[model samples]
Target: MKKLSIVTLLLIVSASLFAQGVPEDVAASAASRPAAIVASTSWTAAFADLGGLDDVPFIAPANLIHPPEYEIIVGDVLKINNADYFIYAGYERMMQSMGSSIKKDEASMIKINTNNSIENVREQASLIAAVMGTQAESSKRVAQYVQVVEDGARKVREQGLDQLKVYCHSMQVFLAKDLGLSVAGTFGPGPVTAAQIAEVAKGGYDLIIDNIHNPIAKPFLEVSPTTKVVVWRNFPDRGGRDSLAEMVGENIEVLLQ
Candidate 1:
């Protein structure tokens, strides 16, 4: 009877162990289910939908006036567009890089006259006029000074310390040809002599000299000559037809209405 009880106890213990194993097996099967696999796949798709791995997600909140990517630099030529902010940033960067090369015009301070009692308004007007006149005069002087400095620097670069024969040839050969002139002889790899420049100048053709001391100037030293010889100093700030016109000799009449 004791042996039978022992066998029965062993069976009961075996039954309990089998019951526990069944639940564990069911849990394992549930974990490996199609729903769980689908859920994992859906999560991955959702994560991808947030944005691809290559794209950066974070953006500055305070960048309300301009987009986060928009940046400005100095010397950047701005145009009408959305990316103009980047151009502006480029301009600012250029200005920062230019160092002392960038110049700012000084503001004129207003002077107040305290001794005006009966005719205070008139005195004030006179004071304002005087101040304005002084400011204008100061501005003119400053402009002239800047021009002189620029001209001196340009002359040094083109002419050097010695008398150099520099040429200022225009690329508008079609126009020159239209005016009954030789286009092939003036440009390209051909040797442009001093005499050739003189001939072109005589025909009212704007010629580019190899140097400033080109012998063409010897022909016409008059204040108001029939033909003009202009030396254009190319700079980052100036370009186009208007700048080209300005480079032509000062004595020539500007035909712009």
Candidate 2:
């Protein structure tokens, strides 16, 4: 019986070692696999870029004025499935179609806030990097994004743009406020109301910072022809500023103009 017990202990130890070796091998394979990410739009792609991903392919065509309204196709689904991470902003029309199809696992699908604010971008980038296991690679890019915002704000101040009374789109107010522009009134993710139009007419607002995605600045421009209309984009335009920092810089340049 003692000899049998010794044999049983040897069997248990061998089983334990084999079991541990299996996980180690699996872990090594997982660690060595290159991360693949597919974004729903260039806006989310920019977030992925900030997280140290160099080749993120997006589903939405960059030419679309409002990318969130883009319909998903079979090709897009294939792209999402082939990738290790599928990143999206929850508002995309495609999300409705993708419902329950994407796994809830953090390693698979990531929903990041599309807001371009420095704080939100930094936070989201860190979150994305944590999932991609690229925090070290992402740190420098994140820092660059923060620096771009700070420098853009400083440039705005230098040009006395902060002194201008501005009318801004609700979606664009975050960037406008960050640049220290004095926003006198705000309007639409929807139609610009009659009351808002009347206010713009007499408000003597110097600038109308409009959203480029769904531009509604025409009415405001007609009401106040003297108010310089500048459309700012949240999504990276086709062949335009591909990075959030570059987009912010371009937006600031538009403000300066």
Candidate 3:
């Protein structure tokens, strides 16, 4: 009998055009980390880079049952209500309720309409490591990609963010937020209407952070010629960021440059 990988028991795929690859450094770094039970798709790449599950576990959103009732399992260290979930394999399991709106107190809140920051990335990575139980190996990878993130923010800031009115796709929203850019508007991780695109262009947005994995870029680009577009790799573009931190950090660098 095939052992049912618990992580994949009852979740549905949100769909991925291309699943980002883990960097060779990340693959090697992930060798000693234990397998954790993760509940959010956003955190999957981080875990993959961290070497959480060798088999590539399913990335599923939380089970929404009984009108906002969260069904949590024994080993599920984290559960998602509205925000990101980083479920590591060991230590005491904990759940962080991601608020619908943005705020500072929360852990890693990466949402479409919400304002997620670079700190969220660092927090997410550290929390994942903490959940894995303290070990020489586990602790070794904590804060691994934080420097890169900080560096990216510094670089973007140095380039200056003023005069950059932007519209972003939902997948790239968190990245946009982390860059601390001037975001005039946002749209889907789902289908968006042509009228909506036209409305955004009319708002005088000069930039669009497009997720290459999603369809948001092309149509929106077609909407306005003056609206410059920057591509974001939703998954492992080169599979070499080593960690989510590195991937995100590098992505921000590309977008700003």
Candidate 4:
């Protein structure tokens, strides 16, 4: 009778375990599932990468002169619709047109200022990391970003390029200043004005740091042909978190040249 009672107890224990509904294979699969992430442009994707995301697909082409102006397409809509998070800058035309349609509760849509300046990049990365629950990963990458900018600044000071007077574009002023260059005056996201042109002619600028996406250096150059113009880009040609740092380094190299 004791043996029979032991067998009965074993059966009851097994039944209890079955009733709990925990399966090893199913639990493992759920834990391992990947998050779906999408971004409006490569710039935003890079920020997401800095935030500790392994994979992020961007909608706008990186080659665009002005990525924020890109129009959203059917595929882009679908991608954002199905993604777990959609990251973007609020300035994008896509966001202006379709932002209202997005169901906020259904999917996370984040808007962050996209700039490669040391402070902006660090702050944005930290903010993004918090949202994604990847603060540990972001802290490491943010350190790398800071190092890259500081190294570039050190290189500039070493080469004596910081002493040269620069006429910088409004959009690229942050980077120009960060590299420790002497910016005498700033120009436009629009056409160089007659007043601005007059100022440039007399400013005796050594270099004109123009925006690669929307160059407005011709007027400044027309007035002062001797002033060398080095075009710098805010957007990266390739997609990756490191691309932002690479872009900044490349800009410094061009300035040095």
TM-score per prediction, in order, is 0.17, 0.84, 0.53, 0.85
Q: Which stretches of candidate 2 lie over 4 Å from their true place?
A: 1-31, 103-107, 238-242
**Candidate 2 residue-wise lDDT, 1-257, digit = tens:** 96455445544543444354436877788778887678999899999988878868899998899999987665566577557788898999877765544433665889899888878888998999898778987888888888888888999899988899988899999888878889888999899999999998886798898898988879887878887889899988742223678888898888787
Task: Compose the digit string of candidate 3's lDDT tens values, residues 37-139.
Answer: 3333334444533433222332333222111123334233222321133333221112232221112223443222111344554454444545444334333
lDDT score at residue 206, model 4, on the 0-100 scale:
89
Q: In terms of TM-score, which candidate is strongest?
A: 4
Provide the lDDT at 172 for model 1: 28
Clash pairs of candidate 2?
none
Model 1 segments more than 4 A misplaced: 1-168, 171-192, 197-224, 230-233, 238-257
Judging by TM-score, tell me the better candidate of 1 and 2: 2
Summarize candidate 1's per-residue lDDT along 1-257 as a digit string, tens digits.
Answer: 96455445544543444355437877787657532100011111111111111111111112222222222232111111111011111222223332332222222212232211213223433443343343443333324433533443354445332132223333323222222223333432234556654555555432332212122343332421444344222111122222212332121112110
Query: Which of the two, 2 or 3, has more TM-score?
Result: 2
Segments in model 3 whose C-alpha atoms lie over 4 Å from true places: 1-45, 48-117, 135-142, 237-241
- The order by descending lDDT is 4, 2, 3, 1
Q: Write down the worst ten-residue block by lDDT for model 4.
A: 98-107
